[model samples]
Target: MKPWSFLHISDLQPGSPRSYRFNQAMGENADTAYKQLGEVEDVDLLLVGGDLTRDGAIHDFECEEARDRLGSLPYPFYAIPGNMDTCNKHTSVAGATGRDDPRLNVTAEQLDHFALFFGEFPWSFVHKEVRFSGFYGAVAGSGLPHEERMWRWLEDELPPAGETKHHVMVMHYSLFIDSVYEPTWGLQDKEEYGRWYFSIDQPHRSRMFDAFKRSGVDIVLSGHIHCRKPPETVDGVRFYRCAGIAMPQAANLWPDGDTRLGFYRFDVTEEGISETFIPLEKESTAEGKYGPGGHPHPEDRDYSLAWEEPPEEFRT
Candidate 1:
């Protein structure tokens, strides 16, 4: 009957100066987003789509700070771990990128460590006649014990849990890149590597879609790719590839892809849910950092280039 609003923000990896790499623009952009979030009114809750920190997988301080920073928001938030917070998706074969992909696969301990700060994920609850569900989709193909639990939860637990006026699913990675049924992208193919890195693979994507349908999910919000594309509806579900809070990536990769930096605001009412893009007041131009961009090998990291002293463990 009455209307309410909620927010979806992701990839605000406000990097720490204490790390080998520190991007000042990202930090400033994240700060701007935080201030803007504080000003928004009548929002029920925030669905943090993930990548809450720059290097949460390795640095406990970053995880702790991300928790505290988000906790300062005007309302409560339900969050899931992004790849940066844990580790990249599982891959036995290295990609076109020089990084050792398999060695960087998300570990069970990494997942648990993330939970230590953000709480257990694959979580669902009903708020204001709307069902909100969040999960780390990367775990689907991880082959870890958590993968079994994720499957069990998606297949068995959620379908019969209950019903609601609407269901919104929050995930870090987009379920698909271009189309829901697109062929799986390959890691070895340089042209297809970005798509492969950004989306869930074949059987898993279809399986998740089926589970979402069975569970009455009408809307799905995801971030990982950072470039927001026009919403794509497959079957009966509307999939929104949300904007990033940090910086834009792959903006020109898609014809309709929007390169703006910001987040999404959704209003729910008796009619249904309507969404809007809230672009950041200003994109950060501040720049300064150490180390390299993209995933860098640990051995290749150079703490000596850091402006501030890095943590003892990070310094070689």
Candidate 2:
């Protein structure tokens, strides 16, 4: 069976000096990973999940810097916008007041800038027998209009009734699993602030998941939880959350000490798909700790190397 490999990373919010430093380190890591991948053989593409910025600030230089770093790779790369990347008002409010606010609006300028930079790709695409789609922002009703339009596109674009193979959907937010369902880690509790971001209600989220299942999407990639954990399977759709490339934060709305900073790699073949988590090297971790002690740390840091084999269903 022919094989293909691609890099998957998320939450590369390069805003503050700390964010910049983190991204620099992540860029270095990506280079190392890519080199190692090259040694192994060929890598077909790089898929970056979202939250590419800190606050979606128009003046944020990190965005450009990130583009430069990511662009250095030899492989063709594609990306989507996360809540932070979307320029929604919540980011500004949270930044200015240091408090959660849900009354924010996604600015026209931010959307325009993102579209210009990203070239207005569809919410989804197909490459090498793999179908890829992504949804932006949180899953709440706050961005309903935009979310609706995206869904409409997805519904229209879904391969006709019974198409199958390796179908993968990538999004900034997790539709199934702890990130969206578990009360403690789910976005429901954060409804007030979530409204400013994005998150659909229970019925809508369920409906979305059903749509993916019906569409025969085998795997879903997401990031925003910041915790490096195994992929969770629900209703036959496997959801994998890529760890943030920058500073770590609370995992799934959990208290501060449960996040891990890292990235992921997906290997695809005619047979199936497999994913592995490539964590920051020891030197990088130490730098993350000593260089900036301010960032939150995970409890009982389980940085040990672990790989979650794709469930039986995903093994084509």
Candidate 3:
């Protein structure tokens, strides 16, 4: 076999100026990434790690637009849903953010909406002796039909996909914050919001880890944290906490966390997979009026502030 390359990027949630919420800088950053990604050559595939839109949960147009743009890539791209694209991870109790966490919980309809646009997820396929698999780990324990599918796929379907030279698993949320044994983050604790927001909770985390081991997964890629952390090799598997292309976050949370805005290029060959970080050619310095960040309530959204007229449907 010959060495092949692929690109992995995520969290390009650069919402449009036509929406009630728009950040010029974030949008430009994503544009930069989009342009830069197109310039790369000879890539076998593009693995989109999710959060492809800012408000895809509420707006179908965002998903359609994203599909068109991503479709323009030179190579085939595989995708999964991020919180912004579908909905935030399931939360039984309200979080410390004061936002209605339960209300923000992921819904079946939203997952259907995402699938309608981006195709069904919890998918697995083999290319060039490597197996690429993606799933929405956030759906675990949600009791939604998608959650059941996720478990069945991970447990039954993926593990038996036959042996491959390498198995690369893509997930939206980090399986754990620092260690696999780390306790589930508490949403009610103000200090744990970042941890809670970024990771999978409880027994689901352990189950997924076990399944990965059984499936002989060589590498795991995750986004949603925005910041990239140093890769951790547990047992024999290498887990990559990927960087976000749209913006950076959780800079101060982890001592080794890198808030650099970039994507990853992996070269797989007989020796091993070599990872390289490709920073955006230009970081957008553009700025504009923006509403309060961090999941504002619908009532608080002000469409009148948009630089462009908000679509009639989005207007409140």
Candidate 4:
């Protein structure tokens, strides 16, 4: 077969200035990546890792904007929902952030809202000889219907469609922080909050890994950390902790983490699939913003500060 290429990008949370708070840099970075991605001549469709919007959980228009922009690309693409698109990972108790973590838990409605635009996830299909699959594993313990459906798909459904020269899996959350067998991270612990926030919790974590191994998923592409790490190969599968398009993060979390902003270009041929990191052509230096960041409480949002008048619906 002739060699072909595809691109993988995630965490492009280009927020709307219409929203209460906007990170100018994040919005610009996402725009730069999107434009750059379009310029790349690809042989196959793009694989969108997730977090396509800043507040898609509450703003359907943002979801629509994302869908329209991505849809305009010359090639087709598949995507899963990020925590920002749906809601945070399921949390039983408030974390060290002092925000209402319990209230921020992912909901069925939010998941369905994302699917309404992006399509139902836990979806997999064969393209040429390779199999591309995407799932939101954060749903694993949410006790929502999506959680059960995702598990069912991962266990019974995924293994059956076994067309493989290579199986590339896209997941929104890292399966683990440091190692596949790492223990469950505690949300209540201040120092552990970052890990807890970025990773899929246990039993679910182990089960997901089991599914990965059982289905012969050799390359697992994960986002949500916003920082790329040196590829980790375990139990024969290689985990690519992809970089964030929205911003850099976790500068001190991992000694080897690469905090550059970029997307991955993968080349597939007889030798097998090879990955390359294509740094964004331009990193937006645009500045200025209104309102707070990081899951701010509703009362904290002052829509009047928006550069543009937000829609009446979002003004609540």
- Flag regions of model 2 displaced more than 4 Å: 16-41, 88-100, 137-140, 143-145, 176-200, 251-258, 282-316
For each candidate in turn, the TM-score is 0.96, 0.71, 0.97, 0.97
**lDDT (10s digit) by residue, model 4, range 271-290:** 98888998888887887777
Which is superior by TM-score, 1 or 3? 3
Tens-digit lDDT track of model 2 for 263-314 = 6677887667888776655314333321232222223212221122222332
> How does each model score on lDDT?
0.89, 0.57, 0.89, 0.89
Superior candidate under lDDT, 2 versus 4: 4
Question: Worst lDDT window (10 residues) for model 2?
Answer: 300-309
Clashing pairs in 4: none
Stretch of 10 with least lDDT, candidate 1: 157-166
Candidate 1 structure lDDT:
0.89
Looking at candidate 3, what is the lDDT of residue 21? 81
State the lDDT of candidate 1 residue by residue for 196-310, as single tens digits. Answer: 8899988899999999999999999999888998887888789999889778898667999998999999999899998999999999988676678777787777777777777
Model 4 residue 107 distance off true place after TM-score fit, in angstroms:
0.2
